[model samples]
Target: MVNSITGLISNIQRYSLHDGPGIRTTVFMMGCPLRCAWCSNPEALSIEKQLMIFDQKCTLCGECLIVEPEAISLDGGLRVDRALIKDIESLAHCCPYDVFEIIGNEMTVDELVDECMKDEPFYRNSGGGVTFCGGDPIVQADFLVEVTKSLKNRGIHVTLDTSGGLPWDQWDKLASAVDLILYDLKLHDEKRHIEYTQAGNSLIFENLDHLAKLGKEIIVRMILVPGVSDDPKDIELRCKRLRQSKANVSLIELLPYHTLGKGKYTRLGMPYPLGRNNEKDKVNVEEIIQIIESIGFKVYYRSP
Candidate 1:
């Protein structure tokens, strides 16, 4: 008998030019518990598997036929006719620019290692490996444990991109599993945090404190979303906390709010969270950067 390494995977982003360190494979896991208004990957939010069809990207090739007849014609353009999905999946395997995609699938740890191993040479030469990004990897504690363990044993560096809003015990279990952490700090005030991201900052701040105390190599991130999250006061609040913490703070990336996920809302039958926010002044980035840097923290315009 053999013990298998199984993990929940929503998307396999190979050759991701941007993330951290170097060229890496980004494994987006499903099921995030955060409702951040500026979330970019809403499709990766649910724990359940879903078929994401981009009408703009689709060629109307009539592919993706499910075994059940009722599963067809999700938006009148999939055109998945009599062709069996087995063949269609193989035929349109990762179509150019992702015409259609099945978000989230369960795979074993061994299977995940096998998949990531394809970039072993790149990892070795560039000092890059797997980055566990998800709705939030911390949400799937056990699977994250198994996957990171396997990757580490195989000499792969693992980075956890999180919101730092997990159970303290879970954080304790996951602390040593990965090589680095990319934690997100959205809003400052507890009330504002809940109103914007729908999560309390108490746990997030607690996790941040614990990570700092553990001497974890952490990179703090703040998404600068125009007038809302990019306000001078909000920026100063998070920056002050970072400076006061034991963690080595770096430059925060001001990811100017964009409508990247606008279409996803309609596809998911949900409304886009884009609300009233002032047009981000182009000078805001420099202003925010200067403020953070003035505190003696090496602040940058992008991800630390």
Candidate 2:
């Protein structure tokens, strides 16, 4: 997709089980400025350099060698070693099969459309389509606009998974191109939001308001984080705010926390804040669904 899409990406998960409606190909983008404490995608936090290792597939052959001090045996589809991968990055520059490779790659809009078009037939049949996911689509707004436009031009359904934290000026270019936006609302309180994500969310709310007014197809998403986002009062407040936003968004998706990305941070030499076994309640999902339904909105159970 580099020749067509103008940005870096790590992987294109084809026929993804969950991400959006149908069997979607979730394009995992790179680089996000936000440092949300509860984020599972540690790999998407930075664009500079990253290291990843699959502990399950490691052979422990002990033939590892890499550029960074922390990196070991991540150069290629090689024999594995029991070495720490933290503090190593130069190792990724020499890989052949993406062993211990970075998650994002650079591509152009034309190039992305060209490459993604390879799966057109599958999308047509499975009610599946392409989903632009990342730290946030707004991080790469320009590329997303062109790519989504191209997809629309060719009669493909386009979905944008974003945090709605971008400036209104940049968003105007993408409004018409995106068919649906899986708008992620992190925290409603300015100070608490800043404290948790290290970034204020006033702009996020403003953008949501604008998008709702525009009457675009929207699905509101909330990460059902345990301590960070699961207070009953907080959920009610969020609900109240949404009731007042008057945005056109009608669907709600509840994404509960999982330990899927903690190992990513370990390979990158970063501490896993949630750590393994930091469990969150699955029971709250019913309550959340009830509340959203009570508000007279349709809700998708998972991240459809």
TM-scores of the models, in the order given: 0.82, 0.82
Residue pairs whose backbone atoms clash in candidate 1:
5-108, 5-109, 6-108, 6-109, 10-104, 251-299, 251-300, 253-302
lDDT of 2 by residue, 57-117 (tens): 5554443453443444435544334265443344454443345565566777877887788
CA deviation > 4 Å runs, candidate 2: 1-5, 53-90, 93-99, 275-277, 280-283
lDDT of each: 0.73, 0.71
What range of 10 consecutive residues in model 2 has the weakest lDDT sum?
62-71
Residue range 104-156, candidate 1, lDDT tens digits: 68887778878998998998888888898888888787777877887888999
At residue 153, give the lDDT of candidate 1: 87
User: Residue 99: error of model 1 in Å?
Assistant: 8.9
User: In candidate 1, which residue ranges exceed 4 Å CA deviation?
Assistant: 54-101, 276-283
Angstrom error of the Cα, residue 245, model 1: value is: 2.7
